[model samples]
Target: MEIKEVAYDHPDAVELSDQVQAEYRTRFGYDDTTPLRPSYFDPPRGLYLVAYENGAPVASGGWRAQDAEDEGYAYGDAEVKRMYVTPGARGQGLARRILAVLETSAREAGRIRMGLETGEALPEALALYTSSGYTPTTGFGVYRDNADSLFLAKPL
Candidate 1:
């Protein structure tokens, strides 16, 4: 797979984002409503990545700087978002590749930690994160109050 950094709103990114949102609706009965902007994924502060196989977009993930004390984030934290692998691309380890790239980019940008919120409904995500050395972390973000929300973090 070929992984490339791209704007959050890039055409391919948007298509994959729509797919992820649709998957979210199928899994939790509603789409994720996190307030996100393209600027949030801009370089130096954040980044978004897309992975392609045979020139077809198949996986994506991103990280945004998050340091709001009131929001329970740390001073040098990077929050992961929009991680998804196309249904047909499952089991190919593309998600892991994208996640590794995201972590490396965030680390190079001086982020001290990486954090993310997933859901119980996404067992594959939980497994990938846990196996990647992410540990349970204090919940943050819009879904923090949701009983099904699961937060994880890793030092970068």
Candidate 2:
């Protein structure tokens, strides 16, 4: 698999994002209304990455800088987003690789921490993040009030 940095609106990136959200919608019966502006994944403040195999996007993820008051986390937090690997890509370690890239990129960008919110519906994601050193934390951002949301964080 090859990973490429791309804008949030990049065709491949958007396709994967939509596919993942569709799965989430079907599993949780809710839509994620997180405020997502392309600027959130713009360079100097954030980044998005897509993993492709044989010219098809199989996985994607991104990180955006966050503020303290609103993020409910420390300043310089890089909130992870849209982490997904297609059904066929499962068990191939693509998601973990993508996550490692995001973490490294966020640290290189001067972020002090990495934060993310994933629902219990995705057990694989929970395991991936936890095994990658992320620990339970107070909920933040869009899912802050969602009972099903499981918040996690890791120091960069």
Tens-place lDDT per residue, model 2, 20-139, is 889889879976789898889998789999999999999999999998676576788999999999999889999999999899999999999999999889899999999999999998
Candidate 2 yields a Cα-based lDDT of 0.90
The number of the candidate with the highest TM-score is 1
How do all models score by TM-score?
A: 0.98, 0.96
CA-RMSD of model 1: 0.7
What's the C-alpha lDDT at position 148 in model 2?
A: 88
In candidate 2, how many Å is residue 122 off? Answer: 0.6
Model 2 off-target regions past 4 Å? none
What does the lDDT read for residue 127 in candidate 1? 98
What candidate 1 gets wrong by more than 4 Å, as runs, is none
TM-score of 2: 0.96
Could you tally the backbone clashes for each prediction?
Answer: 0, 0
**Tens digit of lDDT per residue, candidate 1, span 1-156?**
789999999999999999999999999999999999999999999999999999999999999999996888889999999999999999999999989989999999999999999988999999999999999999888887889899999999
Instruction: Predict model 1's lDDT versus the native.
Output: 0.95
